[model samples]
Target: MDIDHPLALLGGLTPRRFMKRHWQKKPLLVRRAIEGFASPLARADLLALASKEGVESRAIVRDGERWRVKHGPFSARALPAASRRDWTLLVQGVDLHHPAAHDVLSRFRFVPDARLDDVMISWASDGGGVGPHFDSYDVFLLQAQGRRRWRIGRQRDLSLRDGVPLKILANFEPEEEYVLEPGDMLYLPPRWAHDGVAEGECQTWSIGFRAPARGELVRELLQRVADEAAEETSPLYRDPAQEAVESPAAIPPRLQAFARDAVAAALKDAPLLDRALGEALTEPKSNVWFESSRVPARLRGVLVDAKTRMMHDSRHVFVNGESWRASGRDASLMRRLADRRRLDARELAAASDAARALIRAWCEAGWLHETGESHG
Candidate 1:
């Protein structure tokens, strides 16, 4: 992707321009962002996915003055009829379940993978909606089927209605409105309030990005860094030759300094912090799992499993919560695999004996798959 070239997806704004002007600062509505965009997952396919366990899904219905939501594995028999109005089913992480969905997700590679969350599919009947609400993360709402009328505002109240299953705004202030047709898209920065109601029936794909809160990141990183530091040969707390005239309940100043030094020591290793961050970023969601694998006798081209998350930093590569120290040619190859998600004949043949063994180990762990006969 050319950083300077205009993208129809951004409504003629270059990616650089979009990031500079609109990202996290305002909303953008692009008509036909994906020209003639038909949804990769059909309604029936979405329904089937919703019925499977390990997939996150939900059904929302409006009943007169009340609204309700139900968690799924929704059976095919459980879904409301197509003719039915005022009901919707949402399936999260569609990218992990279907190949086409993953391809659609790949379109947003302009953004870093660590920040990109999964694509969610929303299917609704006429009058269906989850009510007006704000997301904590940025989102691209791409209209893929039928039509949806959206009313939006930069909400300030940010209060939710009482006793509702959804976190709907109690005071929705619609400052603008648009009816999104097939291929139209709306980008909303975090906390931009919006509501969408199906015109008749619709499917919308939400490309969401993860925004880790400062406190949340602190907690995750501290835990990982502290665990790593524990493996180091640090001396146990020692307060030798102490004067015992003070209160027993009060922690000593020496102890406090020791505790502080422990934290400082954990942070002292910047490379450890990098590895921890990469591992945390690539960690799979709680619902994700992989099948057991075994190494083949001969090696070939390979592909990373769709569900596997891989990322790298200056000194190390991370995948599915595991970190590896990588350098030299092997590091370059691993980074390429992380970026492109596959290795071809020439790339595979270039691997050293140790690198080939590591690749075989990953294949045996189900992180990668052999695609063809071995060339080496």
Candidate 2:
């Protein structure tokens, strides 16, 4: 994806410009971001997905002054009739299970794969909603079916309602309103408050981006770096001259400083620290897994599903939590796969023998699939 290229999705601004100007800075509303957009999964299809054990889903219903939330795999009897109003079914990671949903997500290739999270589908009845809330991460909410009325604002009060299952805002202030039909999209930066109510039966696809907190990132990176440092060198405690103190309650200041300096020295290698950080950031979520299949010897072209998160930085290629050292033409080929997520027959032929072998391994692991195959 050319970040400099103008996009209808970014309101005619180049993705580069959009990222610099609006991403994480403010909200952006684009009409017909996806022209003629339709729900990739039918209502029944979504319900079937919700019935699966591993798929995350929730059913929300408004009953007068009260709201009810329930985990799903809900039977037909559990749901109100289609004509009934004020209920909703939300299915998370629709892109992971539906091919068309994944295809729709590929349009946002302007964002790096590491930051791009999953797409969630929300199907709501008339007057149904999850209520006013704010997300800690960026999101693109695309209306896929019927209509939804949205009230949005830059909220200052981050307080939540007490004793509620959902983290609803205690006080919501709406500065703008929009009734979105199919194909319209609203982009909200982190901490932007928004509420969407179904004007009627509707489905909305939310493409969410992950934003790791600073402390969480530091912890993960430190752990990864420590593991790498441990493998490289085994430093034993050196206390050549030891004296027993009359007061045995406290550690010696010299010993404390020595331990601190040792840790500091271990972390002093900037390049090693960066590599570990990259690896940790690209690690896949625990629940993610790929299907296994043998690669054809006469492989022609390969296609990576948009739901597959793959990334690379400098010395390593990271895919689904696994990291591999890459160099020469192999590194170039892998980088291309990371960028485009697909390779034609000619491109495959251009790869080195070692790179082809690596590709075969990825194919067997189900990271990459042979193009034109009937896996779907």
Best by lDDT, which number? 1
Task: Report the lDDT tens digits of candidate 2 across residue range 327-354.
Answer: 8888988989888888999999999888
TM-score of 1: 0.94
In candidate 1, stretches whose alpha carbon ends up further than 4 angstroms from where it belongs are: 372-376
Residue 14, model 2: Cα distance from true site in angstroms: 2.1
Regions of candidate 2 where Cα sits further than 4 Å from its true position? 374-376
- For each candidate in the order shown, give its overall lDDT on alpha carbons: 0.89, 0.85
